[model samples]
Target chain A: MYDYSSRPSRLPLPVDERMASADIDLGQRKSIYRSLQELRQFEKRAHDLFLQNLVKGTTHLSLGMEAVAAGFGAAMRPDDYTFATYRGHAHALARGMEMGPAMAELLGRSNGVLGGKGGSMHLTDVSRGMMGSYAIIGAHLCIANGAAWSAQMRGSGQVTVCFFGDGTTNIGAFHEALNMAKVWQLPVVFVCENNLYMEYTPIDLITAVPHPAADRAASYGLESVIVDGNDPDAVYLAAGKAIGRAREGGGPALIEATTYRTGGHSRADPAKYRPLEEVEAWAQRDPIPMYHARLLGLGVAEGELSSIERDVAADVDAATEFAKAGEEPTGEALLTEVYADGSSRWRN
Target chain B: MAELTYREAVAAGIAQEMRRDPSLVMLGEDVAAAGGVFKTTVGLLDEFGPDRVRDTPISEQAILGAAMGASMTGVPVIAEIMFSDFLAVCWDMIANEIAKSRYMTDGQVSFPLVIRTANGGAARFGAQHSQSVENWAMMIPGLKVVAPSTPADTVALMAAAVRDPDPVIFFEHKSLFATKGEVPEVEVVGRLGEASIVREGSDATVAALALMVPRALEAADRLQQEEGISVEVIDVRSLVPLDTKTLLASVEKTSRLFTVEENPRLCGWGAELISIVGEEAFWNLDGPLVRITTPHIPLPAAASLEDLAIPSVDRIYETVKSSLR
Candidate 1:
């Protein structure tokens, strides 16, 4: 078990020193902390549900990567689009997807976001600008670039943020998309959530560069930045700048947020591939507890923090109940919606 | 009506659509300042400017992926893959992302994407450049496969493809680029899933696609004049949402079914049509279904070998004449 108390005595805070010196206000600071807690707690519940065999298919969790979601989500406008990888529940939640529909989707319920057709790997909330998630590594990069290109063509000023892992940077599509983005001056921010592990293998084993953003960004001519992903304030500050620049037609930027998954790659694996000390160290630096510590240091009351936690707990419980009660889709429903105009008339 | 070559009709159609809808963007290698390789998109950069008519790196995956992404955001994208043979390089984006987006999103998303690529073996472009992989696209459920045979149909169908709420694989034939035909002066949009009777006859029904449509027509004229066999030619414009109604009607009248395509004989576009006709109008046929296609060999670079590979007018004429017996 990890400690949740936000005490300065935890010594050498796992986060960057900049978090302590950042100019974030008390209210905004509290909100960021609360968002991380909510995401963390929600993900924990989802993992529990997966263990209980309620989640129909396997799900990739962002257990310790909540700050990246909370920070990036808070910075972007609701109208701004985001394309994320399969470990995308936090992104969808942060981008304003309702917990009921999101959880229902995991349970493969009829009321699920994608009507249960797309389970955990393919969560989409178009209205809130969570364009969709892709399971294929590096596939969504060009798609996000295209969305940004669309924004540029229409002069919408909507910045498209694409979230992928460190492993995805090595994929061919990633390089192609970044190159196209730079050449076209697309208004997009490519966020590589450098979680160290691409599934079982460490990213360094496969990736050619020391840092994905450092080497690849220069090649693509994209304005690049690196941030402590565990620190929400740092991510918010860096991501906000990148997104702002993109919205203002400064072209694309690469923000490599270095963090760790702190969980198994998927539902089945015990993650025997990783070292015990590495896992334990990542656990201690869990974003939720780290954020809690910062909130306490910033003068947040223990009771106030407890109240936010209680509300989040209640919300997640309600979501579970709603998902359990969701109806199972019929075979007839599957035939529908294959085509927009329902031109897949043969199925009918 | 104005006389326009098949290539001109495609360009005119795209330019007309781009003018009407500002969100329609074109992206491909050499499509912008240099115009397209075949010059089908000539003067588009001058008219629409670089942004709408843009050039892309030699990245088919990016071209398709970006086009799909753009389509999801309400911008209709027409991405030219240079040639249908190269579609294999970007098959994942087409088969996985573009084809499955709407279905996987449970209708929450729609990809108004048009993938325009030149199909068929002609001009000794060899195995790499020349291939009629229309059947590969036809097998994918979500895609709308269209191969226009005439300039008018090319202009009309190109309009429909751009406006479609789904992904459309528009296969343009390299051989028919300079083939002249009359196109409407006013803008016309060909309806998807509709077939055109290019040459009407009574003895046998020859359902053809792409480059084979002209050959089937030539064969029909020759058969009528020489052999006194009235051959009905059906231009299978849309392969995915196939115009089975017109095909069945034609087959019912002619009482014989023949499919002409430049795709390989084994498991080609003809194979699917044969099955469909066998299932639906099998009892109505006067004889067995005939499929004329390129031999199942990689198109050789040599002209003599290529001639032996691709189906010719002589082959179609002889087949129809022999089938009548």
Candidate 2:
């Protein structure tokens, strides 16, 4: 039902929102938009690199998912741990893993995250506390729960955020982890980016229940919120509330951010299998342009947006060049990382 | 030297370690109140209090998972997974998380964690709980796997496991719990990469672990008396960082070798022993080193069948005598 071309026309741009705030005059909103553009552009490069590196692989680009990462990413401090799913490109980019190395990782270059070994799904940057992205669906929730419990035990005031899709809710591990989190009052933020599709299947056809994320939260007696994920500002505001409540020992919070995967499930599909009308409708509510229009509405020149775009493009270009040029890791690397000390037992 | 049962020696090892280092803690089902299913932790709660000696929920995953967490945060924790067979529930936490944490973290983290579990089918605990899982430890990376055959070896190796900056699976044979022996009063940490030579001979090398160590020694004693075949018994206390030097050195002296283990033969811990013998001491081997193990079947509950299931003294001696021929 939403108009596709004029999605940004629906609301004030993020730049405009900065102007509209009652008394605050900080350029945080503009900073968020600028930082987000960096995330999307780099991720786009990484996606292409991933496609090139992997033989017959699937890669999910977070083109419409940037705002979610930026919002929650900027809101939290560094020591907090984050567990993300396969659709975690933006989250990694947002968490400050240098663009070049991460891009190299996608390209399977020696310069990548695991010296270009883990590829996209296994990208890990421990300095950022982005515990390695999990390949198994819903299993990461238990790891995140354990990480949060560790934080609670350490008195580090460290918060844990677990990012998964609507499909993860159907898993038994997800339910068990959520129940444990609520019962133990672990300071965890369960971020459900309900992008309306699990992979190819629509949320409705796949799940038995409605409001698949938030409805399940109440069963465990944990507080939850439903937010407009398309709007980064809304996500940031909601995350701020939820993260604050969790850090204060208010148990755990389940945040359902309603959005859509504008791109098809993976690199392969043209998404021709999807009903065209439904796809068109979701595109109309696309997050990028609406925020752009909002920015222009607040007396921001078109040149400012272009400048941000230019910077992002340049960043992505440099990352791609860097990844492409990185030296190939030696065959010895395969022998390495099997253990901390790299025991020579397997070696001849 | 203070006299104690084999169970009491284990308790003393835990108590001494806890007293020696403030960071050590123990968690198992009923470890605090009932003092372990084997009563190995008896009077520990009274001495150490509730926090240090914990009675965890009947969740094996959580028990091992918490120990991994505590270890990561700079404590050396020893957790008991009630029965070695129950370890199947938390195998992921052990193999993937605890065992792999150090290596996966690129040496950023050190998991100085020890897991103590009792294994073997000597008591007829049935197929579900009686299987020897030394092979499971062999499968996991970043873990030092050891099974102590004697009370002295158990005390020493456990102490070494706690002190080592790696995840160590300390397996104690259930049948060996009440079996008393001369354990040293002041424990000396045994070298991990060295195989202890229990008995010396010339004809063959007998390698074993846990209760099988004594059984192999017993088999060697019998082989000498019956056939005048002197077998050198080598206790392979740890399997992961296998003492290839000492083992091969003994194998070099005695061209023939036999392995006796309580576990099943298929992809079993005995396979690794065979492989090692095939590789390192290949030219030295007069013939194939035979592996004496339980037949590949679920251990039966009947006592007579259970005795047949495990490698007996005569069985090991027969295997060794046959290998010599």
Candidate 3:
């Protein structure tokens, strides 16, 4: 079992830990690392907005999961459909869903994505090809499968990236989706953010084989890779390559990211199921600090980094006020949106 | 008038439409080589070939999801769900996604997917297989739910479902398929969301849909002889784009309205019809609207229990009596 807490925790995220320690071309890696820092700062604001959106609803912030989104999101195009699970605010922010609207959506304001109907779990901005996030365990897999199949049929180079937690693999739709994606050579990247434990059940107990969960892909004759989820550059490089391969009709790939959720799955969860020593170990491997240290070693200025952090904090604070000030949707808006033309037979 | 079974008419209607519209495709579990579980897609695979006739894995969500995606383009896709009971699996994709897509997209995006599935109970297919989910589909606006009772009605309605520019759920009764009636072919295009007056009468109007149409017709005949009460039967082919004009006009003339449906009385088609009439033509109604339907219970698995779940001609006649009283 991988210990989550023994690892170091801080900003810039550690690219030195585990498999992410492998170096990339200095120039290219630096550019990705720089963009990642910017995205991190942007997401900090998103996290605050996410909290405000959850009017009693639970919001899972991607404080550690930012690397996976920032990295992969940088590599993908706006046309690409990004489907995600509940812990999706980071993914949404990376996909360009504004921090304010995203927060408004979370707060149940009508100005939010989905007009406040979806809250955090069902956030969708199809205009951005952010297909939508599903709250159901493993349900978005089917939606992505269908979306990818559609893209293949249309000859659209756009691929779909389906993000889910480690627990989603246990659901039947996971394998079914992969098999369908394989059979049709659909453009879809199945990203498994193996944040150690799925909610509270440790990966070892529920996962049967273990982390990476990449081994399961071979049964479908697809290549599977395990990446350092905490390392934004690593996640971005892997996602970029996999998404490119999928766009070229290279079929689907299962990329399992080995990382840890610093917090419990949802707001209310204490995560008592996780062993304290293990949590401390994974925390030591916190992606932010390790990456920030790497940037320092690379000679990036400490002053510039501090400035970026301040900017991010200001952005988040502004978004918080924006979301809070947004008006709630009237009760009329509820049934009004049920249909476009208001032609419900009952309404007649 | 040519005699045709509801199944034969449905198959003929789909075949004629496919022949007319080359872009139309039909795919489902057991719908290809197996000719559908009820043979509704019989000879369709041979006629349309592999491209048009496809057999999908038994994934309900996959089937509906694919159809929704395919319909985004000009390709008209008809997805058959073997049984309406299986709709529980993909209800989200259907209710939330498909039904809300067109309106949410500001009508720029139109999904012309027709989901064909066998619904209602007659065989001892148990709780898992037997369900009259027409009322369930009727709840959505962007999506239209069509039910064709007799062979003629089936032919007219299936073509209409295929031609509709919006998503349509075509529910075919497994029990009614073997029943035959006269059918006509008029260049394969039929008016969707239109009500058909199966039997015209003066005393009372019995508005029914799907399998309930025949039950209403039989009950009307029985009551005509036994109690000297004339019964008018109107088969409501489409549930969502309801032909309210025709339905209200029938009740306006007949004065009395009684609805018969296979679904349970609470929140079913019967309730919807009663509510619609109550809102539109409440004062025009000669008597209070009555609904004859199955009892609210998990469909019975046993033969007797299964038989007792849906409304029959006997129950329809009883409701007619109550409405007259």
Candidate 4:
């Protein structure tokens, strides 16, 4: 049985050590490093847009946690299903969603992927296989399990990637979904973004165990692995193996990616709960700069790295212009798609 | 036409849909080898094989979540929660994910799924096991709610629920499972929002649903015998897209309305029906609208206490008599 009571002293996240000796090829390393840098820039731009009152409602920007999103998104097939949390802009971007429509969605424009209705919390594009972003904390686990089950039923060899936070593991649905996934051997990879804090509460404050993925795997009798989420190579390697195992019918796996949240839980939170020293320490291990250093060490020229940054900046600028010029849905379109078969009583 | 029990009708409805649509799959606790605790899925495994008829763990969230994902992907799914009360465990999926997916996705996806669960009281099962929450589903805009009192209606409505392009909550009353009624030998599919005037009279309109339909008919018989009062019993089978036209026509002829429901008195389906009648046909009403429902308390496990807690033939009769008076 896993011990629940003894609290261990704080330890440095594994990515800190893993980044020093990341054994990735030049081509793969450059690609992974550039992807992390682009995601970071995208989120930072989103933050700036929020500050400028351009992005409406709330955008849960994944400021410091770009490597896990890049790594997991890179490892999965284009047809693989991705069920994401509300802080899913990076996940969507990593899964090949164009920055223009994604930014347009945050702006609640008619040209958005969800036609402006979903805003930030519910971004979906089934054709691209990003099933959607569910705002409810732990609710998508079973639904993603169902997606895996459906693929099994249809003989469609599709794998589902369900992303959630560490706080989600405390929910009853998390236990229920994990147990079912284990029993049924569903083809799903549960990716827990263990950024330490679930909103304001730290993992140790709410959970008995220190590692949520390993603890939950032991409870559900499912296979589990942990990785340094700040290292794109670590996330890519672990998720690649997990997704391959699931696709080959080895059943579901849990991956606990230990990273840190640099931004507030949401748009309005100032993140006063995080200690200044801890934030400063995590800032030293920022995934973007760490990967940038690794790419330079791997013989990628400084000029090429700067070109990647400049290109991403231009891309973010173009995305903003697209969203600002996009249309908003009229009142007539309010009742248009309430029912797939148009059976809503809103229709005359 | 052939006679069948409510259990057989429900099973046949599911089996027929499975046969017609290869993509239709059923999953729930004990629905496979056990054929369901209520035998609602009896002989389904043998006919459809284990792939189509699956036995799930006792996880309501997984059941609903999997059903939502499966339906959105391709196949039409039927997720049978063993009891209607278990819906509370998976209410978020039904209300948030399943019901809202199609609309929230802007019609990019369809949730072709049915949540079939057994409800109602009188078997001494306590409050947790026995509940009539069809009204809770009725309040959701994207969902369709169906309750069948008789086996024939069960066959047609079950088929309709499976065929519906949206999520449907099919509430089957526990007490009515063994009740026999005549159904067609061939397949029957009833449109969801249509109501049936099971019995016709002229004095007052008694709108009842699910298990209350038979009791309402019995009360109508007693009222005709005792006080020469004629009552039209309207089975409001579809609660969400309610057959308000048929109900209002019945109310127009009768000039009085008495709604009977087995759920709690406050905010019940009866209140919605009465409100619709009051709003649309208040000038035709000859008496105040009356609602017959259970008291607002959890049901006890004793037969006497359960009987006292819920609506019954006697309660329906008294409420109707007073409404007519």
Candidate 5:
């Protein structure tokens, strides 16, 4: 009975109105706010390091897209699995990974989370269940399905949450994973951070449908849910429903979060392609300022919010110093971990 | 000892490992109720049931991706890609994500999984279905490659590949599926990177793999009878963790080396072996190391063309007889 053509618009309600009606307790609210603050500080420091040529390779920053990661990270369980894309610093920090190791990894230091082998695009820490930050687009969705299938087979009751860009919706693996996940009723939640652009081009120009991910949900027998990516409360509520359903064996769900990246796609991109008016409009809706104002309006003291911001800044500064003091990887590091035996030797 | 076909040994090998390891699972298209397109996995669904033995859709990416994901997160898996050539459909997952994941993750995750596929030609399936592409996997650093010739080696190697705590690409030859050989009716586990000396001779070392092993043995028999050439035929089973010690010892004893390969002439597995022998056993060689391989071209579907395309018994005989002269 679901109508594909005449589907009603599901853009999230006004942020202040949703915050007033949100059922989240004060402690949870403070945690979400803190995560958002951490994400902002970490990314800004990364950008600064890149400018100073301390970070190597390329980095994809999730500047204005923190709510989607923060909201889901707060809602997910400690044992649950998280699969993220290259723009995954936010997701990694949100999952409670230490910022020092993550920053060291970006700097290609020996004390990195992956010992400087993975760099920025391939950050992985299995201990905290931040499975991996895959560089290849559309590949991790299918991998997420595998993790979910394992959970289902083991009767672990664990849910896997996979995050990707809106650009990934058009790729082959995305469709393949979606169809297979639905067919098997795997316990996974696919979140598409639709920033309205795929790299330099607007996604609407290349894609056939208006809502790339949510529109294709019905084809795979999934319910379409679009959330406000800038509002933590809205994202948290939508994520809770989807995660809860998946945990209770209700199959998989697809959530398309509409948001914008305040900066370019990567460090090299100047972002001159975006119009000035569009950029200004999106900057006005930045998640941090919106969440900060909402917290003050909800009878939380302004002093408390400022203190949280100060603490996050200090943490980012300490992490930067730690990364700077770390040594560069050398010698045996180049020829290790190619196989399970901890050596790269192919023959005797 | 019992005689079993190569395909039956595949099923027995998988069933044996699945019986021992409760965490192992299998997934692929037509792998469950259909018993696989090539029928290499018959009777598995009945023994293991639906949960363990799964029939997946025709999505190669999903099959490999799911297998990698599950293996990294605790459960070991054995996924089928139907045909070895179909690996191209999901090469990104196999080559990029699955192969390099452990190395890139700095050993944080391990993929203890097996990707078994029906490989090579002799049945006129054309170029799309028939390719001895073990070299493609050998070039990748993180994968372990295994291709067995006889029924016993199939079961033993399958056991090794399944138990190993790394990603292994198990290539089961389509041409050898119906061939039967003596298989011991007991628990048999073989080590990776070990070659079997199926024949012994003092004149020259002829290294072959998969279907070419049988052809090389037949050619060696013909050479000894008519041409008076004594050829040592070594089945170079595992390609990645290559058994170089056995190969080097054979080359040193024989003082001459020749490789029989079914892949294209350019950059085949034989090329790597020849390069190694040329480097390490340079003084041990009596003549130039020669590789008898199929020419670099798409395999034709016709019987005559296919026979000529793959290295045959006659081709192997003539190449060795003429090279030694």
Candidate 6:
């Protein structure tokens, strides 16, 4: 229902004027655009699968918050670690997780990303440096510090990027992690995607500060950085700066990207709490179409953008079929991986 | 062999592991320069330097969460949580994150970390500080729970926990910190899930862990000398990866089983053991299985109340003596 060809007229500046100052090259720009498309298509397929009753349990999607994950994922090295929250399908895909395994994971198949043990909330592909997608709020922030500490101890020079929702800023572990990260000078970057709503309620109703993560940055001795989450180039620039500083031992940085989730928090909720005017206003700033128009305005060919979309659609379709074809996890899988010895046996 | 107190052996055990593995790191509140609140981790900072042996703020979640994250990335970490009771504050990190990370990830990323805490009652730190919560860790499926009674076992188990590939919760009894035992001069690593039959007998079998081990030993000696009741005592060291072979064999030989526990009565570690024995060794039992445990109540700071709550040597002796008679 939204217009993809025309740019939003409400913007203060044109797409070229806003993105012209970004330092990213043409190749990186194309890659970020491609990542955005892939994320959007992948999440759409997941939602469709959920409606079809194939994805058991529940899933938290990053439908409109693709730029945050794609931007940070683009800036990160292949070997760098990524810790994200439950709404991590975007982050997982951005880190180069194969769509087949990712979709299979959501479907609870044997060949799923975590072999179906982790289900939808915990999509982990450590091989791709996607360490984990944590379901519990604020827990992975502390865990991210540990990964950064490991890199510091080993002199690996690898930065750890941790992503969470705006809701996490108010949690106790969030403050603890931020304080510890700063005190230790860990090489980590904390990214907060402020999607206006924290599940059913607006973040401002529960949060004390105007900017949840950025306002609290000074409390942890971090610089307050706010970026436009709907703008891929802006997110890329902010993510690159933070990740670069952390990699060079400048310590951790917190970037609060203001975005909006177009869908409900999960498949269960209808998101009826959101006002109609607010939802319509955010739909105009949708990251996918906004970036799509921006790329076209920046001397990109319409055929090239169309080709990328076609490729992403094919990939998503193949991935869906692959997930549908995967075998159910065997009963023996239930008892395995509880310990290092590959068995859950506690007694001899 | 050298005589070392339980507290001293904690440092020695950790220092030994840190020496062997350069990737091994330790962090906790007051654990580095301050040498731990219980003085269990003295000289770690001086030897390992500030980089590896670092002190963290009093954040239990951060301490354990950082340990979990580091271990996932190939660095084995030893985190001290100060007190076993404080684990409740960071229970989400330990229970949901660290314990389930490996299993949830289907073994793609494993957490090779050790969470060593000063556990059990006796210092009269009150209910908040004093608690034998190994049973709390025991109920979790992925954690390996261990409590050592002697200095030698402390050092040995610490070494084993550091070298292990899974997350281990090492509970050191506060009362036994001053208890001295003979530890080998050479590096010694003990296996997990193995119970030590400190004293062997055929009349009755008594199982105890941590601070209860020495008390059970003394009770067994007293029962032999005064009441002429031959009693076998087993140090049921590791709760998870439980040494059921030794325990069931002991029960078969003695035909009577008694558990001396410091945990509260409800859902204590002894309850699990009794259930396992009751199901597996029911025909071998000559009498009903008895458990001497703390009453289902919070520990009080008053010395008299505390003493009456925890099972004493006289209580173990009397319980076993009357049960046998």
TM-scores of the candidates are 0.96, 0.87, 0.86, 0.95, 0.98, 0.97
Among all windows of 10 consecutive residues in model 3 chain B, the one with the lowest summed lDDT is B101-110
State the TM-score for model 4. Answer: 0.95
Q: Per-residue lDDT for B1-325 in model 6, tens only? A: 9999999999999999999999899999999999999999899998889999989998888998899999999899999999999999999998999999889989888888999999999888899999989899999999999999999999999999999899999999999999899999999899999999999999999999999999999999999999899999999999988999999999999999999999999999888888989999999989989999999999999999999999999999999999999
Docking band of candidate 2 = acceptable
In model 2, what is the error at residue A68, expressed in angstroms?
Answer: 2.8
Question: lDDT by residue for model 1 over A21-126, one digit each (tens)?
Answer: 6887788777777688778878899899988989867989998899899999888987999999899999999998999999999999998998888899999999
**Candidate 5 accuracy as lDDT:** 0.93
Q: State how far residue A323 of model 1 sits from its true place (Å).
A: 0.5
The sequence of per-residue lDDT tens digits that candidate 5 reaches over residues B45-110 is 999999999999889999999999999999999999999999999999989999999999899999
Give the range where candidate 1 chain B is weakest over 10 consecutive residues by summed lDDT.
B99-108
lDDT (Cα, tens digit) per residue for candidate 4, span B242-295: 888999999999999998988887799989889888999999999899988888
Model 1 TM-score relative to the real fold: 0.96
Q: Whole-model Cα lDDT per candidate?
A: 0.87, 0.76, 0.76, 0.86, 0.93, 0.92
Count clashes in each candidate, considering only residues at least 3 apart in sequence or on different chains: 0, 7, 35, 0, 0, 0
What stretches of model 4 exceed 4 Å from their correct place? A1-11, A14-28, A346-348
Give the range of the ten consecutive residues with the poorest summed lDDT in model 2 chain B. B100-109
Q: What is the lDDT of candidate 1?
A: 0.87
Candidate 2 regions exceeding 4 Å error are A1-26, A51-58, A202-208, A264-273, A297-302, A344-348, B9-11, B14-29, B32-34, B41-79, B95-110, B181-188
TM-scores, chain A, per candidate: 0.93, 0.89, 0.87, 0.93, 0.95, 0.95
Worst window of 10 by summed lDDT in candidate 3 chain A? A5-14
lDDT by residue (A52-107, candidate 2, tens digit) is: 65422567777777778887887777887777877777887777778888777676
Error of 2 at A172 (Å): 4.0
For residue A287, model 5's alpha carbon misses the true position, in angstroms, by 0.4
- Arranged by DockQ with the best first, the candidates are 5, 6, 4, 1, 3, 2
- The alpha-carbon lDDT assigned to residue B102 of candidate 3 equals 51
Q: What is candidate 4's lDDT per residue for A67-161, written digit by digit as tens?
A: 88899888888889999999888888888788888888888888888888787888888888989899987789999998999998887889999
lDDT of 1 by residue, B1-325 (tens): 9999999988998998999998789999999888899889998999999878989999988999889889999889999999999999899898888888787778889998899999888789999999889999988878988999889999999999988888999999998999999998998888888988988888899999988888899989999999999999999889878888898889899889999989887889888878988998988988999999888888898998888788889999999898897
